[model samples]
Target: MESEYKHLQIGVRAAQAPKERRVLHRVWKYKLMYLLLLPACIWVFIFDYLPVYGISVAFMDYNFIKGMSGSEWAGLKYFQALFESDMFLTAFKNTLIINMYKMVSGFACPILLALALNEIRVKWFKKTLQTAVYLPRFVSWVVYGGIITLLLSPETGLINKAIEWFGGHPAYLLAEPGYFRFILVVTDAMKEMGWAAIIYIAAIAGLNPEVYEAAVVDGATRFQRILHVTLPGISGTIVVMFILRVGYIMSAGLDQIINLYNPMVLSVGDILDTYIYRVGIEQFNVSLAAAADAIKGIIGLAMVLITNQVAKRINDSGIF
Candidate 1:
């Protein structure tokens, strides 16, 4: 019994020592880095988190005059109203559908584009393609919206003119429910695909040339070398990006939808953000808007946690 107690005491001390050492070491080694990051950290705190306390408006009969603290507490009335309303349901569905489409197309297209771009041997051509593809990412949605609208207009638009040339009747592609989603997907894909590929391409570049050389020595073809060596090397980036994409499953492209959507196409194109904008800001119902924002925020957080947990279950690389 005395020996057992001694062993237990030693084990307890050993377990506690590492944690104590960790705290001390972090202070000693990473203190400078932490200090360097302090300004950016404070900026995030000021802008991102300081405003979160105002989320209480979601639970209250918010009045602009009363502000957050003075707002009348109405429990779950605002949230209940959101769930019960048909308009909310339609908006929620549209949000999820468009976001899911964005998630899949946005995710897959970039990976494929990155892989294809990585294969090009011509230095100048590859650089030009990369620049051209990624250039749209920097362009504002407002500018791209005008471009898309002008090009897709039913009357005398480039697409309609092409349709006429082919002896097919010109159609308002953006007006039709079926084609609106496709246009959104394609245009969004086009705008962001090159930019998205940047990270993957960077990852692919980091792979050791020796691996490729070894494969070639073993009589491996270029395709086989890429399939086995290049792909596995960059999969961690893929996994990380995929997890992030899943985390934002509730967020469709608001700017794209706002600029592109018309009343005729609202049934298919209207999303939660747009709905919230119309009901909260335009209609001046602050509490209801706050409630909608709260629900989306909670769901998005849940998605990130679930996705991170899944990634950790498969491998150690996860946001958590």
Candidate 2:
């Protein structure tokens, strides 16, 4: 029994020693880094993690006066109501359609833009072009939407004026449901394409020059080198970004859509976030909004997991 106890102690100590060393090494050697990260840690805890408790409001008949603890537990009533509502179903469908459209088109545009920009040999021109394209991204959606409204106006807008000059009829683009989704997708792609391309450009920049030299020696043309070397080099970055994008498949662009859309286009433009805002803030149905939020979170979590698994299977790279 004594010998057995001795052996057990030795094994336990051996297992714990490495863990202790790791903890101590992190504290001792990387204390400055940890200090630098402290503010971000606090901010995340306060803003992100702390608000997670509010998720419980989804299961309760939340009342501002009663507060969280005093609110009556209503179980899944709000969730049931949400799933049964025709308006919510419409919003959910619209959200998925719009998000998928944006995902497919928006995802490809940045990569193409990055490749085109990468081909520019003139440094000053490339920098100027990059700056010019990226400026739109920094513009607030409200301001950009106003600009778009003016540009697409049937009477005084440049587009309609051009159409009239060409003997075509003028059209109110934003007011038409058929044209709204197209406008949303195209405008969003234009706004963010430059900012999105920066990541791919950085990935392309990190590729070794030796690979290009070797390809040149093998008589590869510029396009051939880009297709073979540049793309493959940045495949990992693309995969990672794509996986992250998939995680947000449920979230249609709320800010842009809210600013640009009107009652005429609400049939196609009313998305989950906008619906949540209407129910929660406008109608004062707090529990219903919480339930909608909970559902979105669950779907997003599942998407991330499934997408990561798919990415791992296909390319052996994933966010996980």
Candidate 3:
């Protein structure tokens, strides 16, 4: 009986040994790919990892001349000061509200756009429309700024002129605190919707045509087909994208916000990124800014992890 047990153990060990061997061999097989990835990996290590050292300054009474070591430690004092500031509160409020709008509007806009494009029967017209929509995405927001300004300009913007032509008053869309954030959300969706649509389009395109053909044979209407077949096929993509967005909850679109924001609209438009620019660049509170950043990073990471875990539990398409 002892000999039989020993034999069974030897067989189990032999069975496990090849998995280890196979893993090592697979690693060796992809050695060149790993070599190719070295630059990007090193770049992340240097830029992303190395800069984390500066997070320490958030706890310090940092000064330029004193340098890192000589700077006095303040523990949680800066954070307490930040939490007490009205501007900080305003910044947090604006950031969350604006980003929530961006996330929902931006996320849904693309999927619907992609679905609409998929439904188009005419190839040439569809292609032209697709090109027109995507063209704005390639253009820099600097150029987009001029375009948007022309459209939203209080005096002569095409939209305002149309309003006047209809005997309505021109709304100074960007200037009003009530309208500014709404405009930001709408414009952000417009600018990036087509670009975001590209991924879903690709996902839809990769789907088996036979499934649609099968749906057609069963007399599934376009809406029904989309609801039943097309959507389920891309649910994983949707979940993954949703998870990814949840990961970046702290980032309000900095470029768009920076380009569009001005002194008149700071109350409605100031976000975490722009706040950092004000604190770090304008006021030279680099260490406090760094601390703010570290806090944002930690919160963002926590959100991602929580979101991913929840997604994994429900749908199993997770970033984990």
List candidate 2 segments past 4 Å from native.
1-17
Looking at candidate 1, the ten consecutive residues that score lowest on lDDT are 311-320
lDDT of 3 by residue, 21-131 (tens): 878877899999989999999999999999989999999999999999999999998898889989988988898899898999999999999999999999999999999
TM-score for each of the candidates: 0.90, 0.93, 0.90
Q: What TM-score quantifies how close candidate 3 is to the native fold?
A: 0.90
Distance from true location, Cα of 14 in model 1, Å: 15
Model 1 misplaced regions, further than 4 Å: 1-32
When summed lDDT is taken over every stretch of 10 residues in candidate 2, the lowest stretch is: 13-22
Task: List all candidate RMSDs to the true structure.
Answer: 5.5, 5.6, 4.6
Give me the candidate number with maximum lDDT: 2
Error of 3 at 228 (Å): 0.2
TM-score-based ranking: 2, 3, 1
Model 3 pairs in collision: none
Candidate 2 achieves a global lDDT of 0.94
Residue-level lDDT tens digits of model 1 in 1-320: 99999999988986778787868877889889889999999999999999898788888898888787787899999899999999999999988988888888999999889889988999999999989998999999999999999999889699999999999998988889889988998999999999999899999889899988899999998789778988789878888998888877777888999999998899999899999899888999988998999899899999888888888888767865
Give candidate 1's error at residue 210 in angstroms. 1.2
1 versus 2: better lDDT goes to: 2
